[model samples]
Every structure is written in structure tokens, then in C-alpha cells.
Target: MDAIREWLAGHKREVIRFAVLFMFLAVCLFGLGRLISGNTAETDTESLQLDETYLAASSVESDQTPVQPQESGPAQEIIIVDIKGAVKNPGVYQAEADMRVIDIIDLAGGLSETADADTVNLSQRVTDQMVIYIPAVGEAAERPIAVPENNLTEQEIGNEEAGTEKVDINTADAVLLQTLNGIGGKKAALIIAYREENGSFQTIEEIMEVSGIGEKTFEGFKNLITVGAK
Candidate 1:
């Protein structure tokens, strides 16, 4: 024991130096762990986040609109006609198959102020080359048909129904028309036979072309008659 005490006393400086070196090593290792701690963990977390972001972007692209697939099929052609009077944007436009006049009006920007949509036959089917006439109100009012002095007697007809004649260009025969003061029996028959063989007349002036109608009689009946329209 005396000899061991002697040796420890002599080596006390060396022991103190060894202890100080060991403490310095421990401090360095702790500092190194603290400095590198945040960077490595952050790198691993960022890598994971980048992988998740890529996955999310991939999913988004699949759901969005893309070029549609083409189909092998026959295409169809469509014809459209325009309506101008009393309509908005009165111009040409594309039309769908099995379309109606009302739908075409909607595409032309809708009706204008003068458009009496009630008078228009919206239910009529649209035709490839049909023309629609939109007549103004009162434009089609019945005109006063002047009765010839001896033509139709007032005694036979009532006052309420007097002076109005709606001439049927298609069916008026010579005998019936001879009832008119200016048209003779022969002329009346000519009118009927001509109207019977042919289809309905397009214009009122066409009646003047019948064999016996002179310029004077045609002038007298000019405003009184209409063809194909009320």
C-alpha cells in the first residue's frame, strides 16, 4: 500500500491531463451531432415530400380534359334558312337536325319589338328553302269590295255582311263570278275552269290572264282580292 501511494502521488499531473483530454473529446462529439442533426433529417423529409407532390400531380393530370377519342362513323349535312323581319341578329346561322322555326329564331338573337310572335306559326316545321312572311298588324285587314250597282243587290244581302268579298282564286267559277257586276257569265266560267285544272294561284294579278277579264274589271277587283293568304 505504501508503494502504491508513492506511485499515485508521483503520477497525479499525468492523470489530470488524461481526464481533461477525455472531456474535450466528449464535447467535440456532442457539438458535431448538433450541427449535422437538422440537415440530414430535413433532406430525408424533403425527399419524401417531393415524392408525394409528384404523385399528386400525376393524379391531377389524368382527371382533367384531354383530346377526345375519334370514332369511325358517317357524318350528316344540315341545311338552315334565315328569318329577318322582327328578329334580333337577323343573319345566317348553323342549325341542328330536326329543328323548328322557333328554335331558329332563338339563334338569331330573339324577337324584335315589331315581332308579333303570336301571329307567327312557330309550330310549323322548318323547310330547307322555305320563306316566312311576317306581316304587320292591320296589313291584312279586309278591304271594302265595291258592289256594282246591279252586281249584288243589297235586298238579298244583310247590311252587317255588306261590301266584303273574299275571292277564292282556286274555286270561283264563271257563273258564280258573273254575280259580280263587272264579270260576265262567260268570264266567270273561264275563271273556274282555269283555277280547277291548275293549283292555287300565287298572285291576284294572275286572274287577269283568264280569257275575258279586261283591264277595267281587273282594276276594279284589284284591292278586293288576295291569293293564298287571309
Candidate 2:
């Protein structure tokens, strides 16, 4: 019994030191495990928050997109018409495709006090480059004019009526030019050739500049012809 007590007394310090070292290692391992778990949880929370924020931004952007408008119809057609003679306002005017002669006359501030309204077909549709002529009250009519005691012959009245039909040199063909006082087929051809070579004639006087035509020839048909609209 005295030998056993002496052995236990000698090993007591070494056993106490070993136990303290084991306790320190266990505490350090537990603290390391807890730190790693906390970091992982924080990372997962941040990832979830970022994913939610991105989804919300996408939804908002989609809601703010603009819608496009639809087209209605084709554009309207524009046309030019020349209003002349006894209209209150005599000039060229722009008109829509659907416009009639009366519509154009209205655009020209309606017919004049002396306008022969019955001589014009107001219901007729207006066309591009069309010329609308409104004659005066005493001018040519579908109804015959009373031959006064002044003794004007029927043939003379007929000649006067024929004079009112002025030929447009700018648009006249060979046949139409022949209707003029001194214009023959050859002269008509030369006129057309000159026109083609140097664009359209700017004025009725410009026809005198054509080859073989002079002031005398122009004076013969000057009152019977027009240059029309340029």
C-alpha cells in the first residue's frame, strides 16, 4: 500500500498538464466551426437579396415600355388648275383630287357679276393642269345670240366665236396648230422641234424666236393663240 501511493504522487502533475492541453484544442475547433457556418449564412442571404433586386428591376422596366401607333390611310392627291376669264379671282390654284369645277370656282372667290354661269358645267371634276374658262354674260353661249338690226351676218358671228377658241402653243400638236391663221404642218413641226430642243416656250412672243417665224407671222395668230401655264 505504501508503494502504490508513492507512484500516484509522482505522475499527478503530468496527467493534469495533458488534460488542460486537450480542453484548449476542443474549444479552438468549436470556435472555428461556428465562424465558418456564420459566413456561409451571410453569403446566402446576400445572394437571395441581389436576385430579388434584379427581378424587381426587370419587372419595372418591362412596365415602362411605350406602345407604337398604327397608320391611318394613304396621302391625298394634289392637283393644279388655272381659273380664268370672268371669275372674280382669276389665277392658278391648288386643289384636291376629289374637287369639282364649282369647288375650284369657289376657291377663286366664286363667279363674277358678268360670268355666264349657264355656259359652264359646274358639276365637272377638276383635273391637273386644267384650264377653267368662265365667259362674260354677253360672250358665246349655247343659245343663239339675237342678230341685231346692225346687220351682223351669221358667218361673221361664227368667225367671232371661232376666234374665242385660242390655241395653246405649249400643248398644241401638228393638227391643232393647223387650226391657227398661218400655221401649216411644216411650221407646226418646226415649232415642236424648237420646243423639244429648248424646253417649253416661256411666252407667246417666244414662238417668234423659232426658225422661219417672224414678227409678221406672230401678229397673224398672236391674238388667236396662248402660251398657257408654264
Candidate 3:
């Protein structure tokens, strides 16, 4: 026991050195593990931030999409015409711009029993202020019973009755031009400007050359316009 004690005392410095080296190694291992864990946590946080940024960017891009334009067709136009003779409800009735005699006949409650359907041109296109006369069967007439609105004499009668005169587009002032159907202050000014820029209209149809004066607008005032000087 005395010899063992002497040997232990002699190796005490070596034992102390060994214990210090072991504690240093343990501390280095623990620091290395903590560094590795911290790096992993930081990488995960960066990856999460990247994912959130990508999602936010995608949402913003989706919200900024443009809308496509919607196409619109031409506006429908209404016309007035007179139906007489064998129609069930013969008088002035509203018609569409493209209505034919047969279509208007249906609008007037169809033809009467005595209507001479064969004598009339059912396929003819109806116009504003047109007179559709469905004559009685076997009836004889000298002049055409179905007179179109283009027949100037009938137009004169209508204008006279309505106390409206056909305006000369070539010479009419803005106030006079506004008297025509569908012609407002703006349209009248446009017409005058068009005439001053391009001279007087040679025909009534040339009025359509003015902006906002399409075929539909022209149709409303065609019968009430003239190119000739008043």
C-alpha cells in the first residue's frame, strides 16, 4: 500500500494534464455541434423566407392581369310605316330597319281573308313611312297600291301634315339642321364643319360621311334632307 501511494503521487501531474486535455476536447465537440445546428436553423429560416417571397410575388402578378375587350354589334334601328287596305290592324305601326312587307304584314295581325297576297311583292324590304296596301282579291287598280316611302309626293304630304319641311343639308344652319329627326346640337355642328371642310354635299347620302352619322343615323333623316339649295 505504501509503494502504491508513492507511485500515484509521482504520476499526479500527468493525470492532471490528461484530465485538462479531455475537458478541452469535450468543449470543442459541444461548440462544433452547436455551430452545425445553428447553421441548419439559419438555412431553414432563409428557405422559408424565399418560399413566402415567391408566393407573394405570384399573388401580385395574378392580381395585375389585364381584362379582354368585349365586342359590341351595331345598334338596332326603329322605323315607322303605314299599313292600309286588307291588313287586320291597318294604320301607322313601328317597324324594324330590315323588315320586309311580309314581316310587317305579320305585325299588322297578318293579311285579311280577302287579301290578294299574290298581287303584292311580299319579299320587298319595307322603309320608313311606307304604305303597304294589301288589296282585296280580284281588285283592279291603276297606280301601284303599295307605294314606298321614297315616293316624294307621299313624303310631301307627311311633311306638310307634320309642319316639318325637308331641310337642305347644303344650306341649312345649325338651328335649321336640328329640326331634322335625331339631329342634335353636336351633330348639327359636325355637319356644318364637314360641309365647310369638304364643300356642299352632292347627294343626301353624303351626309353619312360626317362622323357619328352612320347609315342608321342617315336613315332617320334621309326623307327629310336634300342636297339642293333652298
Give the top-scoring candidate (lDDT): 3
**Quick one: ranking by TM-score, best first?**
3, 2, 1
Predicted candidate 3 versus true structure: per-residue lDDT over 1-230, tens digit per residue: 99988987999898899999999999999999999999999999999999999999999999996888988988768866667678898766777889889988998999999988988898998875566667788776433555653353323322322343567899998766754545666888999999999998998888888998877656655766778852
What would the per-residue lDDT of candidate 2 be over residues 102-177, giving only the tens digit for each residue? Answer: 9989999998999888877888877655556677888855322211112223332223344456778888887666
Q: What lDDT tens digits, residue by residue, belong to model 1 across residues 55-108?
A: 999999998999899997665456445354567675445565567778777887
Greater-lDDT candidate between 2 and 3: 3
List ranges where model 2 is wrong by over 4 Å. Answer: 1-70, 142-230
Model 1: pairs clashing at backbone N, Cα or C within 3 Å: 173-188, 174-188, 174-189
Q: Between prediction 1 and prediction 2, which has the larger TM-score?
A: 2
Worst 10 residues of 1 by lDDT: 141-150
TM-score of 2: 0.37
Instruction: Give lDDT: candidate 1, residue 76.
Output: 48
Model 3 lowest lDDT segment of ten: 152-161
Worst 10 residues of 2 by lDDT: 143-152
Clashing pairs in 2: none
Cα lDDT over the full model 1:
0.60
